[model samples]
Target: MAAFRDPLAGFVPDALVLVALDNALSRGWPDAAVSDLTRDILHASGIADGTVPAPAFAALLGDGRADLVARVRFLRMALGDLALGFDALTGDLPTFMDRAQTFGLFRYDKAMSDTAAARAEVRPWVDYVSALTRLEAAHLVPRLPGNAGPDWLEIGGNSGAFAAAICAARADVRITVSDLPAVCGLGQEMQKGQDRIRFQPRDARKSGWAAELGARDLLLFKSVLHDWPDHHARAFLTEAVACLEPGGRIVICERGPFAAGLADASFLSRLANAVFAPFYRDPSVYEGWLRAAGFAPTRQTVQLDMPFHVIEAVRA
Candidate 1:
């Protein structure tokens, strides 16, 4: 197996990155520690190779700014803490999911209960990430069955950002986002003026959700499926396959277990994985599900820097 690479390996802190880092740091760690750690990381990453000057570092890591101590701590944990039984912190998927539910972190069902406030609180960060990868996703469109004029259906597409990206790239494609009624309403509001994209209320766990959309040429599952256990994930694939037309394709993009070995992953990435470990599986698990759903794999792309995997399969 190839060694895992860090998603933020060569990342230079931009404004957004700094803000996010700051937010994470503010949760813990002192200002002095953060400043010292920021300087150390900057020097080590070669971003402050003596020529950058001390005032620049001061500006970036000033007292009121977000601290980098958490990042330093993550690096230490990734390297040395594993030897001290830190790996025990990561439990299997079921345990993690149970703990998350107990803490009210896994509340998709609640958000879907026709509550606008709950839906509003659920930020569509997954779709934002998808939008960032829009070009890469768009490149796969031509490989699908009806690329010239595909009828697309996205299951659990919150806020319709991914669908909007597809529609923006391919004018001939008509994309529909299927989610719960509350989520669909939020999506419709988010995509108010996009004619190529539409929103429909449907539960993904149930079969025949796609009956109203007729046969779709391409089915998309972005950052979904891993939320459920093996049985539910398989059922989702089965239902998705049933919704597809002859020669139609299914595309699943999600983060999986490939990041466990990423020694240099960002602190935020490590924290997220730790929190959601139970919801992720290996790529092979998804391949098995697709096979069981009666689809043959056409392409698979594993991101080198992150744990994200894009698996595309075709029906018959």
Candidate 2:
């Protein structure tokens, strides 16, 4: 009974309704079962505006609506982090929810759509250039000795998606993508037939096996640093620097400031902070950290399709 009633204590009815309406559970049920349940509860609660219920929910749950209760229970538990408002709950939902959505579920369709939307939305020239700054470290691939291939490490690689993509594109580079155990499991699964990509678990924060990430031509921080506070980020950079080969590079893709007077970027900034945590950085601060970590800054740019500043630096 406690297990069943647990989800009701902090129910956000509107978010449930929104989840129901936008059920793109490209994954299987009960994961995709939010919509039907939300519809029933919203219709019965008669909130009209689609806000979550307080009293109405109690009544609905008390009436032995087990299936409805179960469905709502699942969605409420899944989306508990959303803190959704009535308008957001009722508005047409985005098709995908990524790490930014604050929701536990990672709807594939929504993630792809959100990525596409993010790319289309980034517009300012300086902002785009800033994104490419972090990419510069990874871009060193082209500058490699041309014949002597370099093995690389992709720290905090979520599902090895980008790593696999990179491996597929570059035969000369062997990328070992590392993350937490569970994420590495997912990445391992995703990288199944790819010989150039290997998945491993290496926590970049505390002292662990991460120190073994040794002497590679490039250290890929793809889109990870901003998720941590300054101290942790600094430690990560120091560790990465130590692991690079002479003339080795560090490439980072992180949320950074946009050019002056860009309205769209303001929204993106807020969204990234809310999603990525610890807040994104000013370019100067990031560059400072890079320099202090014994890296020589090379390039910084914001890619047209991304909100991140791509930064490249060489280990000095």
Candidate 3:
């Protein structure tokens, strides 16, 4: 089996989570499936708002792009982690009996979301960026011409996984990866040998990155933009237009379309922290954003047996 981000060591043990399982499996389910069931349980337990009492397990298995034990680990972790509120012994339900809401649950919500405050607080369990290693990272980047020497900028590219992938695939490109300071620190280690790939500290939420970072031949945002509201996303794209030279290219890849949530991003971000991860918007949304930021683009879906959408725009 492929490895995921590693170190789910979030104050809980993998075995301890599995022991709580009380059901049979049918087929591999997506993260959306688990999110819905958990939502139902949360509501049935008397909470109408979509919220989990504690951190949900395997909530991010989908983020890794492959099935980890056919969602068994995710389900079992749910049964184990959030088993305090609901009454586990009643009705058609096989396990949960009460609210099943437990305190002291493993929580990565704070560090993983767009609302994260500082890089210092990020823990091992929140290192979702390395999850890219489990995937063929090369497929995530655009296929540039063999002789094209591109200066690439990867925003929020934690650990420079994508940069390393593309650099291995090409010879003439120099890539700079930017993320939170601490994440950049981690990337510096993961990106030791490749002189072509370097680490630069950047926060996507901040402005003026384009002015400070200078121009690049290509800019890539993989699994990054959807974490923000449309406005911030728009601003980032707008900034990208300035960051790239007049004829540069911008590429954005996300799992699926972002279902634009509540208008208030701060509130939505806070809600997201306590909610069951995220979803997506259509590729057109990104196309529109790209157009608004000044680019004529082409879109393609990654044929990697996963729901990855790639949008590329060249500033003219």
Candidate 4:
């Protein structure tokens, strides 16, 4: 029964063996210490992997009288502390997400039905396009308050996924996805059949956008601000707020802080500098800019796996 519950004991035992090997290699411990820690990590890994039978572990390690127990204890303590200390060195998840958003690693366009061949032609990178689709469907759109039509505008919409999700779910709502010409072109292709969705080539911070995009019930700045500095983010927000109708709302979706997990820090930070260094502002700094632009945040939500944050504000 115990074996059935944790069938992967063999695999886990192997992993613990590897960790022990790596630790031994790094620490240069004496032969005995190396052997002991190796055995413990292998045992623990096996347990975690669900391959090690708990009863077997008890039979082996249960005898507190053995030196093996002491060795296992030392190995666990050393490895756990090492993991925490390394984590500290890597920086936190929020910072990493901010960087990811900036760097375009979160490019979120992995496989557009319209461009699957093109995307597939290139091998996988750490793009976040698929994740974005999920977030738009699950978290970002549902939180939106309006049940109205043709009343939304998306700033920094790269491929119209957000607008597409909105139009797909709520047929009445029309959104103009505004971005630079190249990006708008891609989005235009993506939104081809949907008359309710249109692509406009425009910059968010510029004045002409107001007249071009016109008033909207909701202005969406999805994952754009972190690519900018504070002043620019403020300027963009000011423009967006101006183009909103009275009692209208502006929704900003971004990568939530410290949420991406450990392996992503370097990838995320590098990505941020690439795509968002021009406009990326820290979340706190961006919050201040939003207030300065005369918008008060009414709601903020965090979503997992996709590294997303949705902030809804009303024009004040």
Highest TM-score against the true fold, candidate: 1
What lDDT score belongs to each candidate, Candidate 1 first? 0.59, 0.51, 0.55, 0.54
> What is the Cα-based TM-score of model 2?
0.55
Error of 3 at 79 (Å): 7.3
> lDDT for model 3, on a 0 to 1 scale?
0.55
Residue-wise C-alpha lDDT for candidate 2, range 57-142, written one tens digit per residue: 54544543443433333434434433543234334333223222343332222222223343223212112222223223344333
What root-mean-square deviation over C-alphas does model 1 reach? 7.3
lDDT of 1 by residue, 1-316 (tens): 3444333333444333343334334544333234555545555554443424245444444542312333423333333323333344353433433434222433566556657675654434323333334423554434344452378898888778778767766778889888777777777776899998888877777677557767788888877787777788888887787778888888888776745536755544554345445567877778877887777765455543345667788754
Model 3: worst 10 consecutive residues (lDDT sum): 267-276
| RMSD list, candidates in order | 7.3, 15.3, 13.1, 13.6
The runs of at least 3 residues in candidate 3 whose Cα sits more than 4 Å from the true structure, single-residue gaps closed, are: 1-126, 142-149, 258-278, 303-305
Q: Which order, best to worst by TM-score?
A: 1, 3, 2, 4
Off by over 4 Å in 1: 1-103, 124-149, 302-305
Order the candidates by lDDT, highest first — what do you get? 1, 3, 4, 2
51: Cα error in model 4, Å: 26
